[model samples]
Target: MKNIRNFCIIAHIDHGKSTLADRLLHFTGTISDRELQEQTLDDMDLERERGITIKSHAIQMDYTVNGEKYVLNLIDTPGHVDFSYEVSRSIAACEGALLIVDATQGIQAQTISNLYLALEQDLEIIPILNKMDLDSAMAEEVTDQIVELIGCNPEDVIPASGKTGMGVEEILQAVIDRIPAPKGDPEAPLQAMIFDSVFNSFRGIIAYFRIKHGTIRKGDEVKFVNTGKKYHADEIGTLKLTMTPKKVLSAGDVGYIISGIKQAKEVKVGDTITLVSRPCQDVVKGFEDVKPMVFAGIYPVDTDEFEELRGSLEKLQLNDASLVYEPESSMALGFGFRCGFLGMLHMEIVQERLEREFDMTVITTVPNVGYRAMTTKGELLVVNNPSDLPDPSTLASVEEPFIKAQIITKSDFVGQVMTLCINKRGVLTNQVYLTADRVELSFEIPLGEIVFDFYDKLKTISKGYASFDYHPIGYKESKLVKLDIMLNGDQVDALSALIHRDNAYELGKRICLKLRELIPRQQFEIAIQAGIGTKIIARETVRALRKDVTAKCYGGDISRKRKLLEKQKKGKKRMRQVGNVEVPQEAFLAVLQLD
Candidate 1:
C-alpha cells in the first residue's frame, strides 16, 4: 500500500467537484469510454437536476505514473454549507484534500469555511484554481488570494479546467506528491471510521469507510464501538466509479463493507467498525454533527400516499444521514414526518427527491426555526415543529437562533443589500471594501429571516454578482409571538408560528393575500385571518364560489364526469375542510413567497 493515496475533492457549490471526480475516474481508466457519462458522481436524479452533490461518493482507481502503478481512492463531497457536517465526515476518511477555487469567481463563503475545516484536521492541501477555460477566468488574481488566504505556495496552484480536462494529470501528480500515504500498521487490530453507509435490498446494509488499521476478508466478525453491536461481514467490496462491484478492500483503502444490518439506525456516521477480538487504541472522529436549522412537516397531497411518502423519506435517508425526521401527527394535517433540514436548498432537494423518486406529490408546511420556550410549568422546551408549540397563556419566553452573515458585492449594490437585510430585521454589524468594485458587508440576522430565500433576494439586489455565507451565532431573546391563523372563525391548528413583533402586520397581510390566491372561490364565503393571541391584525374574504360544477356531468358523459370528480377529489385532497370551501397547501407556501 506504499503507492496508495486517499484524498477528497472540496469546493463551493457549482465549483465542479463532481465533474472533476468524473474526469479523474476517466483519466485513471476506472470508467470505460462506452460507460462514461457526465457528472458521474451525481448518481441521483435530484442531484443531477439540481446540479449539486448531496452525498459523499467514493471510488477506487489505479493509475500508472512513470510506469509505476498507484491506487488513488477518490471521495467526492458536497459543497453546500448545510452539508458541512457531511463534508467533515468525508474529509475524515481521507488524509488529503484538493481545494478547488473558481478561477473567475475566486473564493466563496463555503470555500473559506471548508478550508478552515481542512486546516483543523491538519490534512495535506493541494489548492487548484478551476474554470480556467471560462471567459471570466482570472488565474493570477485567484492564485494571489489563495496565497494570502490559505497560505499556499503561489507556484503550487495548478490551473486546470475540469470541463476541458486541462492540467488534470498535474492534479493527480500533486496528490501523489503533496498528500502523504496512509501509515497504519496492517498487522494491528481491525479499526475503521464509518464515514458513510447505504442500505441494500438484497445484502441488508453496506458501510463505507477508510480502514485505519488491520484488514479482514469475508465472514469476519466485527464490532461497532459506539453501538457495541457485533456482526459478521456478510460481504466485502470496493466501489468502482462505474458503479460496478469488486471483490475485496484493504487497509489504507476507501470502499464499502456490506453486512446483515438492514436498518439505518444500526449504522451511523462517526461510528467505528472494528474486529471483535482486536481493536485499535483510538477511534477516529467520524464526522461533525450536522444540525437541521429549518424544520418543516412533509404531508402527502393525497393522504392515501402516506405509505409512499414514508418510503421516499426512507430512501432519502439511505445516503443523506444528515436529514433528521420524526413521525409528526397534526389535528388538521393528519400524520407526517417533521423533517429537519440544513437550509432552504437542502429542504428543496428533499422535496424534489420525494416527488421524483417516489412519484408522489407532497405538501410541506412553512419552514420554522427551532425555538426555545419556557412554559408556565417552568419546563424549557425546544420546539422545532410549529405544530408542537404550546398555548400563548402557557408561554413564558422564546428565543430564536441568530447568524453572522457576510456579503460580498459590488459597491453600487451594497445599499440595496443592506436595505433588504434591514427589512428582514437584520442588524448591520460592519462593512469593508474588499476591492474597488467589491465591498464586504456583515450582519447579525435572525436565522429564520434568511431561511426563506434571503440568498435569492441578495442576488436579485446585487444583480447576481454577490457572494454570501453565514454561520450560526447562537440564540438571542426577542419580542416574538405565535401568529395564529383563523379561517371562517375557526382556528387552524397547523397554521401558527413564532414571529417578531415588528413584522407581524406585513406577515399578516401577506398571508391573507396568499390565501386568497391559493384557496379557489367556493359557494361559501371563506374568512382568512392573521392573528396574534386573541387579536386579529389582518383579514381577507374569499368571495363565495360562483360556478364550479359543469352541466356536462349531468348530461351523462360518464368519462368526463369521472374525470371532473377525480380533479375535484385531487383538489379537495390538498384542502382542509373548514366549514365549507377548501384550503390548500399552496396557501401555506404563498405566505412564504415575497412578491
Candidate 2:
C-alpha cells in the first residue's frame, strides 16, 4: 500500500483536464504514442463533439522511480457545475486531487468550487498551471490566483502544457512525494466502496470500486451491503486503457468486478461491497446522497414504449447515480417518468443520451424546480410537477428554492451581468475584486429563475468570459403562481409551469406566441391561451389549414359562392369543437428557449 496512490484531476470546463490525462498516460507509458489521441479518457462521442467531459473516467497507471515500481489510480472528473456530483464521487475514492487551472483564464468559478469539494474531503491538493504553451498564457497572474485560492506556496505550482507534455515528470514526482498512500488491513474482512458502475449487454452490470480492506479474488462470493443480494465475482480486473484481469486485488487498490447480475437496481452507487463468506462487520460510509435541483417529465412519443423507457432509464441510472426518477402520468403525455436532474444541462444530456444511446424517442416537458407548499391544513407538501400542486384555495403559500450563485467575470461586463441577474429577481449579496480587471460577484437568486436560459444569457453578455457556479441555499417565500396553457379550452398539463407572479403576464404572452409558431396548422383552428386559474392572461391563434371553397364556384352565381363559404364555416366550427389539437414535440422544447 505504500507504493499505491489514488488521486483525481479537477478543473474548470475547457481547462485541459482530459488533455492533461492523455499526457499523464503517455508519460507513464500506459499507452503507446501510436495509440495516443486527444481527450483519450473521454470515450463518449457526445463529450468529444461538445468538447466537455460529461462522465468521470478512472484508469490505473504504473510509474517507476529509481527502480521502485508504484501504482497510481487516476480518476478524471468533469468540470461543469451541472456535473459536480461526478467530481464529488471521484473525490470520495481518492486521497489527493490535481487542481489544474488554465493559464489564460485564472481561477474561474468552477475552479474555486471544485477546490472546496477537495478540501472538504481532506484530499492533498497539487496545483498545476495548465495551457502554458499558449501565446496569451498568463502564467504569473494565474499562479498568484492559485496561490491565493489554495494558500499554497508559489513555487509549489507546476507550469505545464497538456498539448506539449511539459512538467509531466514533475507532476509524477509530486504524486509520489506529496500524496500519501492508501492505508488498510489486507488481512481483514473484505470491504469496498462502489463509486461507479456501467452496464454491458454481453455480460451484466460491472461495478468499479476501491477496496478499503482485505482482498478480492477472481471468483469470490460477494454481497452488496445496500441490497443484501449476493453473487459470485465472474471477473475481477484493474481499469487501464482496457480491462486488465488480475488474480487478486488487495486493499487500497481500485478495480472492477463483474458479478453477472442483470438487474440495474441491485447494484447501487455509494453501496458497500463485502464478501459473503467473511463479510466486514462495519460498512464504509461511501458518500452523500445526490440531491436533484431540477425536475421534468420524460415521456415516450409512442405510448407502447413505456416499459422500454423505464428499462433504459434504469440502465442509465446505473451509469449516472445523480439521476433520480419516479413513475408519473401526464394527462397530455401519457405515461412517463418525472426525472430529477442536477441542472438544466444535466437534463439535456440525459435526454440526448436517451435518443442516441438507447434509440428512444421521448418528449420532455418544461423543466422546473421542486417546490414546497404549505397547505391551509398546516401540512407541508412537496410538489415536483405543476400539476401536483394542491388547489389554490387550499394552498397557504408556495416556497421556491433559492441558490447562492457565484459569477466571476471581467470588470467591464460586471454591470451587464448584474443587470441580467437582477432582472431574474436576484439580489447582489457581495462583490470582490480578484484583481485590477477581474471581479467575483455573489448573488442570492431563486433556482427557478435560472432554470430556463440564465446560463446561456450570462455567457452571451460576457462574451463567453464569465464563469458561473451555484449551490442551493434553502427555500424562501415568493409570489409564485402556476401558469396553465389551454388549447381549445382544454388544459395541457405538460405545457403548464409554476412561475413568479410579476413575470407571469410577459412570460405567458411569450410562450403563447412561441407556441403559435411551433404547433403546425391543423384542419381546425387552435386557440392557445395562457391562464392563471380561470382568468386568461394571454392568447394566440393558430389558424386552421384552409381549403379554398370559393375556387369551385369561380364565375358562378354570387349565392353559390356565399352558400359554399357558409357551409365551410359550419364545418370548421364543428371540427374545432370535437378535434383535439396535437401539440408538436418542438413546442415544449421551444418554450424553454423563448427570449
Which of the numbered candidates is closest to the native, going by highest lDDT?
2
Candidate 1 lDDT over residue span 1-595, tens digit each: 8899999989888898888888888888898988789888788877787788888888888999999999888889899887887788878888899999999887777888888888888889999999899999988878987897778689999999889999889999999998999988788888788888776678777888788888877778888888888898877767775444445556787767777886667787788888887866677766667778899988887788787788778767867787888887876678888999988888887888778766878888888889888888999999886656678899888889999998878789988998999988899999987657767889999998888889888888888877887888899988887888888777776677778888888888887877877888765567898898788999999876434645556676688877876776656544535345556776767767757
**RMSD (Å) of each candidate, 1 decimal:** 6.8, 1.7
What's the distance in Å from true for residue 446, model 2?
Answer: 0.5
State the local distance difference test value for candidate 1.
Answer: 0.82
- C-alpha positional error of residue 180 in candidate 2 after TM-score superposition, expressed in Å: 0.2
- Candidates' lDDT values, in order? 0.82, 0.95
lDDT value, residue 202 of candidate 2: 91
lDDT tens digits by residue: candidate 2, 171-202: 99999999999989999999999999999999
> Which 10-residue window of candidate 2 scores lowest in summed lDDT?
548-557
The regions of model 2 sitting more than 4 angstroms off are: 545-567
Superposed model 1: Cα runs more than 4 Å off: 242-248, 304-308, 545-580
Best by TM-score: 2
Clashing pairs in 1: 522-545, 523-545
